[model samples]
Target: MRGFLHLGCVYAHGVKNVIHVMLENRAFDTVFGFLNHTTDIENLVGKDPICNYVNVNDPTSAKACTSPNLPSKSQYDPDHQYYATTNEIYGTNDPNVPLPPVAPMSGFVQQASIGALKGAPIQDLQQVMASFDPANIPIQATLAKEFTIFDKWFAAIPGPTQPNRVSAHCATSNGWYDNSKIIFGNNCRSIFEDLADAGLTWKAYYQENPPSIDCLSNLRFSSNIQSYSNFLSDAKSGNLPSYTFLEPKYGNLPQNKNTYTDGHSGSSSFANAEAFIKQIYETLRASPQWSSSLLLITYDEHGGFHDHVPPPKAPNPDGITVNDPNHPGVVYSFDRLGLRVPVTLISPWVPKGQVIHEPNGPQSDSQFSHASIPATLRSIFKLTSPALTKRESWSGNFESYLLDTPRTDCPTTLPSVVQF
Candidate 1:
């Protein structure tokens, strides 16, 4: 129920606007994999010597797994369902299957091949091991070159979009893994509630209504939800809220056209997503609020792409475990984080061309996950009591990357999306 006019008055002291754009289903190595091929730009992919792994079950896995020759323009959506993501992560397609003592991280090609064989041609399996050219994702790549990129940022859960997204907003999915059941009745407290409790304002902008909306039981917050057009208008007028969550257009909707920007499979090209990002950046840069705003661009899930890095063990968000009757006997403790996803932090405050990774620690290596979203918000708002979850309570904050002074050399525009 908070209005834009009141946002300025309520948040005048040390209050900076945080804009989060959550894109769908892209892995770090899947979209930015080609950055490893670049010589001058120091990146996580190519720093280590390139090596190939052998998967006897997967004939297509003999060569170097990360290939730029993989089709970037194709509309092939890899299998990112709950079990499929498990296969892509643990390298085992079977659900609740025991993994070897030394996890191989070698089941991608086979999983893709198996996924393709179901309702898709067997020959299309090669698309799973393929990645896009860095040139094709110039906007994201350019941002990485200009701001801070998290090579170790991971999804909160190793499942599908709904659960991972729920973690980002609520710190826990409330014992649900897939997107089947509606969450409005779940009574979960979201960051939205946290912001409101602190007397700060927030907004959720979507091209169309996203699945996350159903998770919120309170209809009073519905007043803050607006169409995507309102986002552009607010950005230009400097009427942005203290926190903004933006959702790209999911391609499955009836109104979605060839210019889908969500970057999900079946989209015409990744160019659409780049163009969308470019516009958002330009709008923010041109506004008076640019200096005071921080923009975070990240993906919800890995979308079944091949990533070399294994996910690290993580603290359980809530004590309640997920015992889904559908996957009988499959108990989820929410202990392990998901695969790596591309995470770029853009602001005048961040250092140029900075790459952040896990810092040494006695516990687990320092890494960013979807839980970091709420954790950072809680830190910024200075909320003291009633933490969301232990995972978020221990998560690292991105504010460390913000500089005491702002950079004037941030690029205003990026290369146009190249058509295939």
Candidate 2:
């Protein structure tokens, strides 16, 4: 097992607070992948050349292209369900077998067709293959250019929201492989618990109700969770916790209108998500903690959108594997990571326009997933003991991006989205 001895050596220099904000759905390519068309950004992070198609019937006549626009509200939800995602990754709906070593990642369009045809109209179904122009999401594109972007960051599971999110909070998802298993009744030890045990301060701020915080098994720390309204006040007062997890509003239901900034499927618009992020950035920049803080912005999963890169092999979280009861023959060892999602690291300690896609040392893998969240917190907080899981213990930390001297000219504001 890797020891926490490396923690003191790495984080002892600066960095007092770490703020992580997790958004919903959007894929790396679905949002900023088009930035590859620009020479400078392309030279820095390379590109994802995978383009999708749309064909409900006659597969031979399928049109090949990337969807160009993502409206504020989607008419149909992409197929991000458990089994659908498996097919999206493996290019086959065969749940009876383990994923082959050579996953072609070519089944997105096919699986999406199945999902779209279920209850959606023909027009809505065709939108699955569509993507947004980088020009459409100016805020994210601007931030990616100004801050450090992790081009290879991935979700923790090949499935949907809940499982992958659980992986982010605690290295292991227990035995879950789908969102259906997620409920308020589920319990697990999370990074919050680890932080508390080490005598550190942490907080979970939600726009309305807390989706992720409810996953925690121990209710003793419930007091640490607060409303999103309190977050801005805390930042203004310089009373932020050592670690903070910000949750966006999950949906745009009537009650959620006030807090609904999450960019989930069928929501008002991605502009809301960008605005929410900009608000956080501006608030943090004005806070006294700005100099000593690191902010991470990322998504939970691909949300059934298309990402060209294949997930790499991963360490099994707890040396345990579970067979999918739904598909009697399918078994998972938690040894493979999920599809790619955009992750950006912002801190004055990081260089402007920095792209982190490879491990600093040759011994580690370049790819990172949601497990890196707990792994990083464990390392920085010096929580010496067994890690939540072996996978997190082995995951790479982002400390390498922090420089000896902080940059004073980082941007204080980002571009706004231009509505059509």
By TM-score, the best candidate is: 2
Candidate 2 clash pair list: 67-130, 67-131
Model 1: what TM-score?
0.88
Looking at model 1, report the run of 10 residues with the lowest lDDT sum.
1-10
Superposition error at 409 for model 1 (Å): 1.1
Question: What's the residue-level lDDT of 279 in candidate 1?
Answer: 92
How many clashes would you count in candidate 2? 2
In terms of lDDT, the best-performing candidate is 2
Across 1-420, the per-residue lDDT of candidate 1 in tens digits comes to 211111112222233899999898888777777774334332335545333333535555443345665554566777777777777666675655685544455666556656743444434555665567777677887888888788878888887888887788888877767777764445668888889888999998887665355566663358788889999999999999999999888765666757678777665677788889999999999988998888999999888777777887788878878786777887878877888888889998888888777622213444578888887777667765466988776566665556777888988777786765
lDDT of 1: 0.73
lDDT of all predictions: 0.73, 0.74
Each prediction's TM-score versus the true structure: 0.88, 0.89
lDDT of 2 by residue, 1-420 (tens): 222223346544478899999998877767766665335432213433444444324457453435566566664568787778778778666765556886776777777766754545444554554567668777777777777887778888787887887788888787777766656445767888888888899998988665566766674358888898899999988999989999898873577753467677664677778789989999999999999899999899988877777888888888778877777766777877778888888988887788777444212553477878887777667778567887776676777568888889988877776553
